[model samples]
Target: MRSRRGVIEVNTAQIREVADGVPDVCIYELLYNENIEVIEDQCLSKRKCDSAILASDGTVGIFVKPDLPEEYRQFLLWHEYGHFKLHYDENMHFNFYLSRFSWKTEREANTFAALNLLKGEDIYDQNVIALLISKGVPERIAVKTYESLI
Candidate 1:
C-alpha cells in the first residue's frame, strides 16, 4: 500500500491553478452562515480536525486553525475543494457531510490534497520532509503525514 519514499508526483501546479482560480472567499464562508456552523452541524472544526465540508450545492467548507501557517491553510482548503469536485455526487444529496475517513471518499480528498500541495514531489522521497517544511507545513504534521504514507 506504500510507494518508495520519493517526491510527491501529482501535478500540483495545475491543481494549484485550479485552486487559485476559485472565488476569493473562504469556501467555508460560502457554505455556512458562521464558522461555528460547520462545527455545530458537521462536528468538524479547525480546532480539532484539519478537515472540511462539502455542501450538496457544490460548495466546500474548509476549517483551518487560524494560527497555522498560510500554506497549510491553503492546502486544507484545497483538500476540501477536492472533495467537492471528486467525491461529491450531485445525485446523492446525503453524502456531502462526511468524516475524514468515511470510506474511500476521504481517501480521495486526501489524495487530492497531498497531490495538490506536493505535486511533482514524492512523499516517499528522502527530502520529502524537508520540502514540506520549506512549504510552511507544520513539522509535526509533516512527520505524521510522512509516517501515514507508509
Candidate 2:
C-alpha cells in the first residue's frame, strides 16, 4: 500500500500486512503512511456520516462530518478507511459515502473496521464491551464484533 506514490489505489493484502504488523495502530497515521489524506468537512459528505473520496487529481481521502463526537469521529474515520482499503479499487464509484444501513458494501466496510479495531483485544473479558465502547466503537457494533470473534 505504501509502495505507491502520487496515486490513489487499494491493495488489501498490503493494507492487512501493515495493519497487522503494527501493535496499537493509529488509524490516522496508518492512512497517512499509505498516502491517504483525512478531511473534516460536513458539507463534503452531507448525504452520509463519512465518505471515501478518490479525486480526479489522483488524491485519495476520507471525508468526515466535523461535528460528531470525538469517539464517533474516530470510528467513522476507520470505517471510511475500510471503504478505502477494501472497496475503492475493486468495483466502487470514485466517491462513496456511508449510510447507517445494511447494504452489502456498508456491512463489509463495518466488519472490516470492527475487525481491525478489535484485533488483539481480549474479547472474553467481562469488560470487553465497555472497553471497545470507550475505544470509540459503538455499542451495537462492539457487541456484534465481539460475538463474531467469540
TM-score against truth, every candidate: 0.48, 0.66
lDDT of 2 by residue, 18-132 (tens): 4465556778778788788888776855564454455445678777766778877777777777666555564334333333222544555555666677677776645777877
Candidate 2: segments with Cα more than 4 A from true spot: 1-24, 44-52, 55-57, 90-102
- Candidates' lDDT values, in order? 0.52, 0.62
**TM-score: which candidate is best?**
2
Summing lDDT over every window of 10 consecutive residues in candidate 2, give the lowest-scoring window.
1-10
Off by over 4 Å in 1: 1-47, 94-103, 120-126, 136-150
How well does candidate 2 match the true structure in TM-score terms?
0.66
Model 1 lDDT tens row, 83-150? 66554555554443343335445444554555456765555646876776676556765666555454
Q: Which residue pairs in candidate 2 have backbone atoms (N, alpha carbon, C) closer than 3 angstroms, thus clashing?
A: none
Q: Pick the candidate with the highest lDDT.
A: 2
Candidate 2: give its CA RMSD in angstroms. Answer: 6.6
Supply the global lDDT for candidate 1.
0.52
Write down the TM-score for model 1: 0.48
